[model samples]
Target: MTTIMSSALGFASNRRRRAILALLVVEALSLAVISALHLSGVIHGGTRPYNPEAAGIAEAVIGVVLIAGAVAVLSSPKHGRAAAQAATGFAIAGFIVGLTFTIIGGQPVDVAYHAIVLPLLILTLVLSLPKPRDLGVGRDQGPVSKSQ
Candidate 1:
């Protein structure tokens, strides 16, 4: 019974991790589109970034980072967990700031984009957060003691 329950929990965790990866991919793609629009002089908004070129460059870099994070999340379990956490946290911060700026000083299009993306980023972060370890999930030992 315990084994079955543990397997179920493990499956759920894997599903959640995959969800996080999918969200990250979506975010990366969205950032790429935003970057392209800004760089192409298609989206000129009244906001903190007076220079659309610089903002667009930054967005492109962020998108690249997000793509890297998605790749990392598909790696080993420990590494993937860390990558997911970092990626989601960074995206959440960026989106929140963008949302605030858009709401205060930018166009409605910008506002709507930020508003929609921020919550999804938050959800990704939440899902990426580590949970308590399951008993006998993988190895019998958690980690070796340094003093040992």
Candidate 2:
């Protein structure tokens, strides 16, 4: 069981995976922390009432997706790539949702934090994504070599 857990988590050792993990972690943490702050009255007042519990639930799903994507990429690149893509989408969506909240008169701190966090998420997602060349789909191949 210990070995199995290690195997599942082994991908995080790779530098690329680690970078992605950092971004996901920070995004999740920001939501969780801000939610706590909202509940605690450190941040209050918005068009939409701050719902920390709801935010926590969303963060939990994002966290699961993040961990699963990282682990899946290790065992199967095909599935892992898809998972990573989905994870990237989720990250970006979360950032956009943060912006939407601000637009709707949410807390100023939410916008300020999103300003800092969104760039990190974007950078990591950009790095994790497959380049067209990686899929043998970029640039001119010059000539196709025929083994036949």
| Most accurate candidate by lDDT | 1
| lDDT digits (tens) for residues 43-120 of candidate 2 | 666676444445545545665666666666655643554566678678678668757766567666777877887787
C-alpha positional error of residue 45 in candidate 1 after TM-score superposition, expressed in Å = 4.1
Best by TM-score: 1
Where does model 2 exceed 4 Å of error? 1-14, 39-41, 49-64, 71-78, 138-148
Q: How far out, in Å, is residue 47 in model 2? A: 2.5
Model 2, residue 127: distance off in Å is 1.2
Worst 10 residues of 1 by lDDT: 1-10
- The models' CA-based lDDT, in order, is 0.71, 0.60
Q: After the best TM-score superposition of candidate 2, give how far the Cα of residue 18 lies from its true spot, in angstroms.
A: 3.1
lDDT of 1 at 50: 46
Q: Which ten residues in a row have the lowest lDDT in candidate 2?
A: 1-10
